[model samples]
Target: MEVTTLTRVYRYDGIDLPVPPHLAGDPSALRAYHATLYPAILNAEAVDLGVSNGALVTEYRRAVGTKGR
Candidate 1:
């Protein structure tokens, strides 16, 4: 049987945070877990960076305000 493994990485604050295996497949759960680690991530947007090097890269970008202009 052919087996494939998925590696998930969370890019935030100019650092790469490896996602926990248990929360890898669950986006909501993953986000919640990350929020616990980085409260700012609660408002961050998850931007999928697509797969590279057999790993899934996701970036959590904080929302920027436009000064209500």
Candidate 2:
């Protein structure tokens, strides 16, 4: 018998992360959603870079604060 290993990816399907109807075309809601998603993005980047969560969080907060202002 032969064994083969399968590669894995942590990709998220959109179905599990649906956007709210009210937020679809609203700029403010879009901004808020972007701000909220920044942290997750940072975390993913941190994992890729093998960095600390603090740095990613700092960057996320900075970006969110500036853009969400």
Candidate 3:
């Protein structure tokens, strides 16, 4: 028999969120949600990493305006 282990990591306020039952049991759903959420999460992380909130907001506005064209 082969055994495998899976790990998921999330940080919140310098602490970790507990793994939910859905994520632990359904790998595909977890993967899909992660993919959908990744961009927003990464953008927030970039904002935290020294990018000013005003700059981030302005960039987001520009992106939306460009996409609306």
Candidate 4:
């Protein structure tokens, strides 16, 4: 038998950030948590990237129309 631990990652503002253990498994909470770190994320959208390399991945995308404003 083999056991493996999965990690969580957040991809926002073109940067890959390691997700805090407490925020794992809760997408909305994770996003709000990230917003504290990156205020701009408050206006962004969360996009799940599923799992990759044994880690859960998510991306935050800002509104396209608000780019230049």
Q: Pick the candidate with the highest lDDT.
A: 1
lDDT of 2 by residue, 1-69 (tens): 986543211222221223466775563454456546543443222112222432211122122233333
User: What's the lDDT for residue 6 in model 3?
Assistant: 36
lDDT of 4 by residue, 1-69 (tens): 998877777899889966787778788887788888888798888888888999877789886773464
**Clash pairs (backbone) in predicted model 2:** none
Ranking by TM-score: 1, 4, 3, 2
Q: Would you list the clashing residue pairs of candidate 3?
A: none
Which of candidates 2 and 4 is the stronger one according to lDDT?
4
True-structure lDDT of candidate 1: 0.86
List runs of model 3 lying over 4 Å from the truth. 1-4, 24-43, 46-69
Pairs that collide in candidate 4 are none
Candidate ordering by lDDT (highest first)? 1, 4, 3, 2
Clashing pairs in 1: none
RMSD of 3: 12.1
For candidate 1, lDDT tens digit of each residue in 1-69? 998886888889888876787887898998888888898899899999999899888899999987564
Cα RMSD, each candidate: 2.6, 12.3, 12.1, 3.4
lDDT of each: 0.86, 0.35, 0.38, 0.82
Can you write out model 3's per-residue Cα lDDT over 1-69, one digit (the tens) per residue? 975453544443443334477675574454445436344432233112222422211111111223333
Candidate 1 residue runs with Cα over 4 Å from true position: 1-5, 66-69
**Per-candidate clashes, comma-separated:** 0, 0, 0, 0
> Where is model 3 poorest over a 10-residue stretch in terms of lDDT?
55-64
- By TM-score, the better pick of 2 and 3 is 3
| Native-to-model Cα distance after best TM-score fit, residue 1 in candidate 3, in Å | 14
